[model samples]
Target: MRDIHIQAIRVHQYGGPGELKLEEIPPPVAGPGQVLINITATGVNPVDWKMREGMLARPLPFIPGVEASGVVIALGEGVTHLKVGQAVYGSVDGSYTACAAADASRIFPKPVHLSFEQAAAAGGAKIAWSALFEEGRLTKGQRVLIHAGAGGVGHLAVQLAYHAGAYVIATAGEENIDFVASLGADEVIDYKAAPFETQTGQADLILDTVGGDTLERSYQLVKSGGTLVSIAGKPDEAKAAAAGIRAVWSGAKSVRAMQEVARLLDRGLITPAVRKVFAPLSAAAAAQEYSRLGGPGRGKVVLLIE
Candidate 1:
């Protein structure tokens, strides 16, 4: 049989957006317990640029993209829950292509109400869910602070925390305070207006999406016995111990988390905000650059494959 080739964005040598090259490559096959998907859209994430810039190393000449939304075209052996032609969305390796094969366990049925772009953007919800509930152990009536509340993960985290009955306090710039509040935040602190530590009260949990100084400042904000969860990097154990608080690093990609997020989406309980859309695969580099510069908050950047 003749091999089928698809146009994809490839990074041969890590450097910058320039490394993202559109090329003709053989499409990945659906291996055991995998599903071949015709990718409709891909979510642009910081990891995409980090991998391209060598911060996160991968094999040379590999495709870049972690999550996407698309239709299943073929199913690998032993996969029974999904069928070909089913619309699904999930984390997939090399999603910056027209077609990519994903592990069957990771992908879930796309919510019917969401556009392909919206589904792609919601990929960050898994991280948000894990951070807010799994790592932070947030509970109803407890105070939870979400840093960067208008960001891709933060926005979702804010809504999830709020709907779960937690007192959701969020940090954002002056521009996004209202936007974050609209998403169910009980309070939105304009971080630029004042030091967040000074403006916010002690919280039962803090979800740190912005690391470095933000994470450093959050230790004092959490009440004793409270938890601080960071997705950007590992939290300092000594600082956490000294503060009498629990600190956790959240980066787990759980299928169960994704499934729960999907249910939320289908029920209109949580909405994914897509900030920008670039098309035709060739725009992968530009999309990454946009995301790197922090494309409009309260959403994610998406790449629409032609």
Candidate 2:
């Protein structure tokens, strides 16, 4: 273990945004099959706040972020694929801090083209790609409708489906309709102005990044034998059976899923749109932004750590 400490946001209790508190904590040791990292940046997702709110239960007082970009500082026993001083990005333990220890297989090389802030947002892209292709089984020449098309995951989903030769339709706020269109969405629907189901009737696939009523309504938009994959919440199986479709709730829970997205990112085929970046000390402000706008803002919220 290193005789050093790092600053990170820690939650001692489950509540709202105010629960996230900045603290000075000891640096973590890399366990076997893990690599220690000096975190450069962290991407804030719905999971972060959700976990803080006790929606996802974890042991209290742990640093919150998981999706991060950083440099390898140390390696654990039996780890061989990566070496010291290499730049990598992936889901890591207590990633809101200045240092982290992450799974070796799950961490990926930071693309030369993207800044650490951009690379840290890779988890969102990977989740979208996994939900659309791996779990949703999106195929070419089919119609895919993405809810919250301008969100952290939804934006990437739109691009991936479009590039995969799917006829892409996306629903967004009226303010982001053109932005979603710029990402190659063939059709854009303003969910506030109209019902998305009316515009996109019976799509082959529907990616639900917005849960609650969105998931419920999406069951109606999928054609028979189609699939509805969700990242926000688990879809209702009875509803899926009633609609003659499959409702899946799974995404990039593994590093291999992130590596696939890294390849696309390195090749410049896809990118994460970062909406706002907060300084390390401004974690509270970042949490407030996420709560005010939710995680589906036009892009993602990131924390810049020096």
Candidate 3:
């Protein structure tokens, strides 16, 4: 048997980013339906911090990180389509590490023209696209409102909706209006200056990424019989029934959805924005700063593994 050593960030107890411990461990092996990847870059999402703090439900002794881009090094039995040395991107367990063993179903071949950083950003954007375009059934020419338009998911949602022929309205902090607009949003509202519900009246679809009041307010902005799809919060089913609107909380993790994202990425219809890059050793500090910033841009904070 061959042995390899790789570095990963692990958390024994959940709290703040300060709790992350960097350690070296044996490189992961591919199991049935799995593939080992030499991770080049990993995209950091809000969920990483949430999971780290135990706010999200996950098993303990967790290795945090969601999205990554890398090259396939090994494949498990039954995995015949993907070959070693092929560039691929996907969501995986413990993406912060130098090497990751991911379910082959969650992986996709990376676009030849895209850099590793861009592919990393695509990981989170693809989930957003699946939620808004696939499950939400967003249509062209309809008015769609996306919360946090400059965010990893929101930015892509804006572009996808625009490409789909929707009149895209997006909300973001004042500093991000231009960035959101550049992503093809028709109207950019400053979320702090005025509530999104107040700025954009009834819409055909409302994509909510911020929960709590933001999620609640979204209901009021959707026209009667309109749909409110949330990736961050659970909608009020009772309220939706009363208002004649459909509300749902959607998550994207299926193999098919990941493949769809890969297709879009390969076509250059969508791209990931990278905001910052940090060494694997600085992952804890990066997480701390990310949480502090509240995740500002569509740009992804990445840990460069290689």
Candidate 4:
């Protein structure tokens, strides 16, 4: 019941980047099992823009942001794992703000070696890891292909797949072939230059981030009994059944998945790639730019609070 105010970006009506408005709102209070975070940096996801434009299903007048890095300012009753002043980062409530209140379960200690920008990028890395390793059931010695190899999730997925002892293949623009290769991709296919299905076939697992035609093409590359996991599109179950392959669609908002990501990051086994940083007030403009420059090696776009 303390009086505090913080700057935030809010969307009253869903539309394009121009819809986002920056204004002052009451600083969030730590509720039961929640922690108040003083956000330092927030990551911009494609979903954030989609959510803002009413593309993804959500309530109106919502604060839009998913991943962020910050310090804990307060803890709710029954919270014990975190303390005030601890540097932490995660995808939490309305991340486009100077302060936030998030479930304690979703927060994790920021990696000691990562900067605030890097931590903001790490948010997508965790999701990629969970969708690929945990849900996709990726195994060592398997052949894996990741679409958009230089994207926020794709780059990390490439590294994680390679680190897991998989023969990793990645699809990106010709310009990003070397970047994906440096992340340990055994082969890099230029999706723009050639059809991925024609270049790489019989993948044991496929991590599909780009939906529609990309998803349809991915199904052709997975071997029988293989799994195809998508974060952006719903898997065509009928198509999978016909091809004798398994398909999974990932939904965000899993606490367990977030914790798993934090562990991997803390161990320094995986890292996020950050391409640019924008001030919080400029998040809308940044999102427009990110959408325009869609490709590999562009990395994650982040909004800095301070």
Question: Which candidate has the top score in lDDT?
Answer: 1
Model 1's alpha-carbon lDDT is: 0.91
| TM-score, structure 1 vs. true | 0.97
Candidate 1, backbone clash total:
1
lDDT of 4 by residue, 140-190 (tens): 999998998988889888988988899999998888889889889999999
Cα TM-score per model: 0.97, 0.94, 0.94, 0.94
The local distance difference test score of model 3 is 0.82
The local lDDT score (0 to 100) that residue 28 gets in candidate 4 is 82
| Model 2 clashes, total count | 0
Clashes of each: 1, 0, 0, 1
Task: Choose 2 or 3, whichever is better by lDDT.
Answer: 2
lDDT score of residue 180 within candidate 2 = 97
Candidate 3 ranges beyond 4 A from true positions = 1-3
Report lDDT (CA) for all predictions.
0.91, 0.84, 0.82, 0.85
Worst 10 residues of 1 by lDDT: 291-300
